[model samples]
Target: MSQTVDRALSILPLLAQGPADLGQVAERLGVHKSTALRLLRTLHEHGLVYRQQDQRYRLGARLFALAQEAVENLDVREIAHPHLVELNQNCGHTVHLAVYEENEVLYIDKVESRYPVRMYSRIGKPVAITVAAVAKLLLADLSEAERRSVADKLDYPMYTPRSTPGAAAFLKELAAVREQGWATDLGGHEESINCVGAPIRGADGRVVAAMSVSAPNVVVTAEELLTLLPLVRRTADTISREYSGSNRPKKV
Candidate 1:
């Protein structure tokens, strides 16, 4: 990249951290005051930076508008679908992509297994929040207070004997899931179904979605399914990179 363009682009993040005066900007960029002024002026003309009455430079309104527009237009499902398909093909099991919204974790996309014993779930269906791997991964990213509040309000149905039984247990599960950065459902939702999941993060490192791979115990034992954790995590990370515009997604 050209030095001029790189220097101009660097100002946006600096100003985002906080406004800075001309000398501070120039010092940070390791450039002379005149060169820094030129860069800042160019950014100002493009409405990417603002000059305050206090003489500090800050990110401009147009930059914010563009950021919001880009975020609003980003479809996590669209970006993750092909990756999900690739995962299913590799593992020969059901793969799911889910997101938390309005206090619910819902499946936003799924790729079915090639085998006959497929998991019965649909797009937009709210997950078994107390026991699903995808739900655990999504909810684990919530702040402690948010997770506690959500845990307290949810019904702890005995989807299976292994399912999370109450708020305390569910909270404990979420805490572990958060610390470990991954989650699993070992016959918790259904007696024979097992799942492993990983969180898909945004550029800011917050969980924006989760992806999972699942199969019946007959097809893949819980231990065998657990072995897929690394693959699931790799796929999730790839989707995250592509969705967050950090790096191009690679072949799984």
Candidate 2:
């Protein structure tokens, strides 16, 4: 990319943090005041940045409108199906894509397990939110207060002896999920099933969805399933980039 375009693009994120004066923008970009002014002027004319009477600039309405429009048109399942399929093929296990809706985590897509012993789940089914790996990832994205509220109201059914027993344990699990950027379920929802999952983030870096791979303990031990976590995360990242319309490749 050209230096001019790069510098101009850099100004958007700066303004997004809050309005900034000419000197601040110049310093942040490591460019001279006049060069910064030129970039800001171009952005202002394009309605991506707006100048206030205080001589500071912030993001413009046009940017928000464009963002909302793009989000409304994004069909996450359409963008993610192929990646989920690829993950399923690589792991030879059941793969799932899920989103939080109406206060429930719903499986939006799934690929059947290649083995004869398939998981008893289908697309559009509400996940076992209290203990499912994909559900943990989706719920972990909620605010602390929101997580607390949800944990308080949920029924802690011991789907197995390993299922979340109460709000405190569930909240702790969510906190760990938040810190780790991924989650797992080992005989939590079912005594014989295991799952590993990663979050799919949007351009703003918020979790928009999650994907997981699952198999029966008879097919693969928990330790073996975890070895696929890196692959699961990579697949999720690929889907996130396509869904967010980001062309930049992941750096090592």
Candidate 3:
């Protein structure tokens, strides 16, 4: 890869974490000051990045536009959208599409139910890896050491009474999720909200994303969640095949 291109790509996550000045950016990326400046200039010209008045840098509008287009054109979503609609209508619950990125689960798409009492999950919002059922679904794909590294990096805040309390506790829950091939969040992220999620595997047979159904605890009991497992798992499996092509054996 071109030096400038590599630098620009590396800078994206640093900018996404927050904004940063040239010196800070260079420090984090382990490049010299001169190289960072040249890379930033090139990226700015391409509209992939931009600078603020105070001299801090951020992802530019062009990158956002590209990401929006990519999200709209994602093959997996194109194929799974009709299925998501069916799942939402049949289950009468809010169905969300989430992909694992870095140490967090990012919600990329959702179909909300018409019910008055519903969880308001928005696209582009990120939640802790230890708090959401979707996170657990993705976590199951990681090796034990990989999971521990991720758990350590995570904040693991107790958003609700059911949220995992610490890294060790979270790892135990992850172990169970791995064994079960599904995950449940019972009022963990929000009070009275319950979610059940299953991992979406790619043709590489690696877990790439999660498909989840969220409902109020009163409206969808634990038993109801269990009943919905097959639907969630099957939808995820379909997405995996469509996106990844063929199933490769999953490694633990």
Candidate 4:
């Protein structure tokens, strides 16, 4: 990286905890006051950082503008939101949209269950890398070698009585998921809470993410979930159309 860019980038974390003065930034970065000043000036000029008369520095509006652009560029959540709401209303169950990120499943969006009894999971929560129906969908997207490697390295904790136990079991379940294009958590992650998930394939034929509908086991049977399979897949396909990956080259 260029010296100026690297110097400017190094100060971003400090700005995250609110703002900082020149001396404090210089001290944290282990640079002379003059060097820090020069870097800050350049950053301010480029709108990457901002400075106040109180001598404190924080991230600038340019960064926020860039963040807005990035968010606008991401169409997955936009497309999924309406479908998820519909799914929730129709099934009277909670619905979630989860994407793969750094080996974990990140909940990007979700809808609450309409039923009186239900399990609750939050958006932005990072679930375990090895478990969960949505996580399994991500694993299905990996190449065989990558899948094996990830399975080998994972902790594979037992979240509940029905949770898959080891790498071998996980592999078997993943195979089923690939074959069926869906996965199930039969009260796996949390006993008595069942979930059914289907992979959302991009135009590239890659599994981009998974959408799930979850509810109390007693109220929603696996058979009932299976009955809703076609709707769930349709919803996923509709949203995948708006996903960025849909524009990429597909496998078939």
Candidate 5:
């Protein structure tokens, strides 16, 4: 690496330990005080470092802002949207993408069916945690302690007779989902609706999000819905590959 770029990058890890004075930074970098000061000035101009009231240098607000922006840009919904649409086209049913964040599972993307009969759902709405297939898939990936904690905290609304009744049942269901690597909500969230979901994993093989296919019971029986499981799993796997950059175009 170029010496200037190398020196600038080195400052970040040094500051991460704790704020440091100019002399300390210079000593650690094994550079002249003037050289360290010049480097710090360049970093400050880019908002990568800050000079505090105590005159020590620390990481800057801009660094955090940039980190936030990077996370937002890596949205799984954006990566999964087209796959959801393609799955919807193949199955003729509603397709949804969801993620668990801040103790809530919410729909981030959706592709409505072309059929006259369709399920009523909106993107960005929090899921029925006890009964949504996507919700189950997302929650199933959490550790046992986190699963129990979240299960205890949820309201087990009886939207239907098939809805999960309490934490014990919910935990049991999550265990089944975790074991199977996929999930379903058959007339649980809505008496007329059935859903099947599979986890979309990151490069580390952790479920970062989930996608589901939904069809009204009036349109398809639970057995028929189950028939789509392979397709759903395939689509989820495709999204996981793309999101993890495993499918990136190879250089010539």
Candidate 6:
């Protein structure tokens, strides 16, 4: 609906065909040359567009990076779904796969517990960024500056007495999670819910996504949940290996 956004988005597909000069972009957008230049400058600043030696604009390296990330996320979900199911089958607990995107962490896949007792959650739902185990694992991998930035912006709602109290505490928790290479939410998001989570790393050893196994206190004590950390980490490692192509069968 916004003309600036519409024009900026139009430039991407236009440039996708090939590089385009300022005059060409202006003509295609039906806007003044200065207007097109301003739009291109905005896009360039965001690394979505590049100005070449010929003074023509083309898709920037960040575009390819974003595209690759999208592809990797799709592959992660595809590769991790069966693993999640298997973990749920073995443990009879709810399994969740989540990724951080646009400053929000959302569940991309979930396997319900086989047991009649189950946790309530939905795929595509944004997680409790400050308290969820998967959210912690994902955010913990971010740079210290980024972590502080995000933590400063979040509301530390006391979902439970165990919930992280504020930015300082959340940042501290993230540090511990990053150092330990796994995280947990014990009565953090909900009074009765507890979760243990591990990071799924990419080929470069960056956290690409996180997966968790969750159960309620009524079903499993905190100590019982802690006992499953090894299993959860193993499952997360398996997903990471497969997603990174490290688990590919060796040639016979």
- TM-score top scorer: 3
Estimate candidate 5's alpha-carbon lDDT, on a 0 to 1 scale: 0.91
Report backbone clashes per prediction: 0, 0, 1, 1, 0, 0
Q: Write the per-residue lDDT of candidate 5 for residues 29-104, one digit (tens) a residue.
A: 9999999999999999999999999999999989988866754565577788888899988999999988898789
Q: Candidate 2, residues 39-133: lDDT per residue as tens digits?
A: 99999998999989988999998987886575445488788988989888888999998998656998878899999998899766689999999
- Considering TM-score, which of the candidate structures 4 and 6 is the better prediction for this target? 6
**Candidate 6 lDDT score at position 217:** 88
State the lDDT at 116 in candidate 4.
Answer: 81
Question: Which residue runs of candidate 3 sit more than 4 Å off their true CA positions?
Answer: 1-60, 244-252
Local lDDT at 131 for model 6: 97
Residue 156 of model 2: what lDDT? 89
Best by lDDT: 6
**Candidate 3 TM-score over all chains jointly:** 0.74
Model 1, 26-82: lDDT tens per residue? Answer: 999999999999999999999998999998999899976885575445489879989
Q: Which of 2 and 5 is the better model by lDDT?
A: 5
In model 2, which regions exceed 4 Å deviation? 1-74, 246-252
- Estimate the Cα RMSD of every predicted model relative to the unseen true structure: 14.7, 15.1, 4.5, 4.7, 11.5, 10.4
lDDT of 4 by residue, 1-252 (tens): 697777778998778778999998899988998999988888889898888788789989898788667645556777678888988888888898888866677887888887788676776668755668889988988889888888888887788867889999998888888888888787778888777788877777788779888877678777887788788888887777766444665445
Q: Each model's TM-score?
A: 0.68, 0.68, 0.74, 0.70, 0.69, 0.71
Error of 4 at 146 (Å): 0.7
Ranking by TM-score: 3, 6, 4, 5, 1, 2
What global local distance difference test value does model 1 have? Answer: 0.90
Q: Please say which candidate is ahead in TM-score: 3 or 4.
A: 3
Which regions of candidate 6 deviate over 4 angstroms?
1-73, 246-252
